[model samples]
Each structure stands twice: as C-alpha cells, then as structure tokens.
Target: MFADVRRRPGNYGLGGTFREASAFVNGCDAGNSWGLLIGFREWLALKLGCEANLTWAGLILKLADVDASLHPSGSNLSATEDERAVEVLFAELDEFLSARKGASDVGRILEKYLRQNS
Candidate 1:
C-alpha cells in the first residue's frame, strides 16, 4: 500500500487514498483471490473505531495526533501535514504488520512486499 502510494504520480490524498486502495484490493480479491481484503477492511475499520465515515485521513490524523481542521478542504494538506501523514502511515503500517496474525497468503505477500519496499 505504501509502495503503491509512493509509485503514484502526484500527492496522495488522505482518506480518499486509503478508501480507494481498500476498494482496489477488495476488487482484486473479488473471488477470495487472497482472502485478505475482507479481513484487512475489518481490521482497518476496527482500528478506525467510531468514525462516522471511517476515512484514511481521519485515521492518519488520529494516529499522527494532528488536528482535522488543518486540512479543512480534505484535499489540500499542507506540506507539514503531508510529512506528518507519511510518518503516521509508516508507523501505523509497521504496527499493523507486526501485530497481524492469521493473514491469508495474499495478505502475507502484500505485507512482505511492504516490508521489502519500505
């Protein structure tokens, strides 16, 4: 996921990026291709707690201890916010991979890819 974001062309928006990535992964596993997306979504949803929208930006800001108003427009995160977002992304990702269990082969592969690339 991090690698996917990094390989992209321009600025990776927050909540939208995560939502899209999750959807893409889910689509890829439409027929339980890896039996991972559902679990991943569930885990992410759980991590997000009671967010009404459950967006990646919310999770990122929560994890980074940043204020939501910093990006009121939701798309134009400041340079500092962008840096903090990346930091929170890597930190949360590391935590997720370290604590993950019972992951499908595809999930393991994805995690491995992230570990290798990161």
Candidate 2:
C-alpha cells in the first residue's frame, strides 16, 4: 500500500516520492514540514469515499490517526515523533487486521472500524 502511494503521481502536493510519503505515513520526516501523513490521511479518506478498498483505507486511516496524534497541527515532526508514531501505528494495524481478516469489503469494514475505533 505504501509502495502504491509512492508510485502515484503529483505527490498529492506533499512533494518527494511516494517513498517519502511512506516515510511520512510512518511518521518520518513529516514530508517537507507539511504534515504529510495528515495530508495522506485526508487524501486516503477522500479516496475511501470513492474507490479505495476498506482494508487499505482502514490501514491508511490508522496510520494517519497515529501521525495526527503525534503532530496534530501538521507541523514539522521530529525523528523521535516519527519513531513513536510508527510504533503505535504498526501495533494498531496489527490489532485491526487480526480482528478483521474475514471482512470482504474493507470500505464497509473501514466505516465500521472508524465508528468503533473513533
């Protein structure tokens, strides 16, 4: 999923390759000081309403949630912030995917996950 985002065009205005986006999503670099993870989360959310899969969207949102909590205002985050956010994000993703392995459409599953998790 991170690789896919990296391959996409325009950098969604966040700059850097999708690898950088991946880093940002993982709470690294913050993507040019623009809160890349938050931006990616918003982009993913919009995509979710359109054509994204539920499982992937849920995962993206989960990452975004971690990034947002670490850098709520989208400011430039530090390596320590990134590291902490990534740690929490992965733990949450593990828990989330483990519980929803049987779900067919992640979009619907994501909606439910957000409702319950939020």
Candidate number achieving the greatest TM-score relative to the actual structure: 1
Q: Tally clashes: model 1.
A: 1
Off by over 4 Å in 2: 1-75, 104-118
* Residue lDDT tens for model 1, 89-109: 556654565566554643664
Pairs of residues at least 3 apart in sequence or in different chains that clash in candidate 1: 15-57
lDDT of each: 0.49, 0.42
TM-score of each: 0.44, 0.33
Q: Which 10 consecutive residues of model 2 have the lowest summed lDDT?
A: 34-43
Backbone Cα, N, C clashes tallied per candidate:
1, 4
**Cand. 1 TM to true fold:** 0.44
Tell me the tens digit of each residue's lDDT in model 2 across 1-118: 4443344525544444322444445554244364323223323444335433333324443444444443433345565554443444444444444544443434555565465445
Pairs with steric clashes in candidate 2: 6-18, 54-106, 54-107, 55-106
